[model samples]
Target: LGGGMTNAVLALAVISWPKYARLARSQALTVRQQPYIEAARLSGCSDTEIIFRHLLPSVLSPLLVMSALDLGTMLMELAGLSFLGLGAQPPAAEWGSMMSSSRSMLQTAPWVILAPGAAIFVTVSLFNLLGDSLRDQLDPKFNPK
Candidate 1:
């Protein structure tokens, strides 16, 4: 389970990095176009100085929201891998492990599988809802014109 969780997190970080970089770059580009950035540039601010001192703070909110959204996805992927026996070992009491063990008994005691499956479903859903809410609140694009 630990290994699976680690792998999932690492994979997500790697795969999602480009998007994050793009967001940062886009934000930086926008910030750079602002008058304050122009003033700082005219005052002889370096590129790194402009980015770290000026642009970073402007994009912090969306960056934080995106990070929170990523957490839920990483959890779901870890649970999925664990459910497939590629994750948690036996007797660990993880939701995925429980579902895996209950597969054969699915017809006999559907509750056993349903319970854990439902838990995972609800957790994932809640995280997704939270992420959507955060995005809506943090990003101007989602706002009604």
Candidate 2:
């Protein structure tokens, strides 16, 4: 329970944190300049109130989209680490671990590698698709139809 899972969690956090921070920073900077935000500031809204009430709502959509996209990337990273013996430690059923352990079986039973490879491909593709759909649905420009 603590081995592979912990490694994966740590890897994912290390890999994904920077992208999220950048996204939030950029979004907050842009949203902070919007007319409503400026008006709120001029009208005596506290910084905390402006941030939580106004800034967050505007920036949250992109955060959601990026988070969906990050999930797949993080999973792929975990699998790659597992394949390299750095993640999802032995005995775990992660696709990368499966692929790594089944390396010797590649010649005799290609199906073993194929199954995990296919799973990783499909799962990552699905996550990317979900992220794209959410981006389109949430963005005002994309939603206009």
Candidate 3:
């Protein structure tokens, strides 16, 4: 509908929402069957209390990891949209736009095209690594033993 950064963000959010929703739903379902949840129920805790005190904490780690991992995907998607002229306006500085604008110079000043491409690669790789490290740090099964 609209163009520019806000539109790009909304598009990314729309694309991302379903995955996180499914993940949260599955995590909550698993947590719901845990002994602590059962104990909380036996202790007469309300659903809201149990959800906030138990389910949320139990599910937050995985969600954090998912969000971290999704960042790179979102960034790439936004960049692709910008490259296609469907995202950030001309005035806005975006790597994809930079690459797109320099496309004609590919045979002349290849660095113009390569620089943004390399930047995108490095940034995405860093974000993926960040997600991996976050998962390692947060997952209980990551014991170095």
Candidate 4:
């Protein structure tokens, strides 16, 4: 179970990082054209120094928002995999496994399946809402008048 979660996180990080890196690079490229960046360069600052010190901070807000959104998605994927028995195995009382095992009883005792399923639904929804809120708050382009 632990290994599965770790692998999921690792995979998500690896897959998501390139997109964030591209956004960061685009932001950095734009920031680099700013007068301050030119001034820094004129003052003998290295490219690495300008990127880390100037450009990175400017793009952190959107990256953080995106990361929060990714977390909820990763959780859903993990739960789906676990439910299929490809993740957590026997003896573990994971929500997915519980839901999976209750599949046969779903017609008789629908609550058994509904309970865990609802929990997963609510948790994922809350995270997604929170991420969207964060994105709205952090993104200058979405600023209210």
Candidate number with greatest TM-score: 3
Q: What is the C-alpha lDDT profile of model 3 across 1-145, one tens digit per residue?
A: 7778888898789877998899999999998998989999999999999999999987999999999988898888888998988888778899988888888999999999899889999999999999999989998878765
- Model 1: runs farther than 4 Å from truth? 1-4, 43-49, 140-145
Clashing pairs in 3: none
Top-lDDT candidate index:
3
Residue 124 displacement (Å), model 2:
0.3
TM-score of 1: 0.76
* Candidates 1 and 4 compared by lDDT, better number: 4
Write candidate 2's Cα lDDT for 47-103 as tens digits.
999999998987899999999997798889888988987787777778899999999
User: In terms of TM-score, which candidate is stronger, 1 or 4?
Assistant: 4
Go through the candidates in order and give each one's C-alpha lDDT.
0.78, 0.87, 0.89, 0.79
Q: How many clashing residue pairs are found in candidate 3?
A: 0
- Candidate 2: the clashing residue pairs are none
TM-score of structure candidate 2: 0.89
- For each of the candidates, the C-alpha root-mean-square deviation to the true structure, in angstroms, is 3.1, 2.4, 1.4, 2.9
Q: Model 1, range 1-145, lDDT digits (tens) per residue?
A: 2455456557666778898888888887787789999999999999899878988887886787877777777777767777877666675667887888889998899999999988888887887788778887877667665
TM-score of each: 0.76, 0.89, 0.93, 0.79
Ranked candidates, highest lDDT first:
3, 2, 4, 1
Candidate 3 segments whose C-alpha is farther than 4 A from its true place: none
Provide the global lDDT of candidate 4 against the true structure: 0.79
Better of 1 and 3 by lDDT: 3
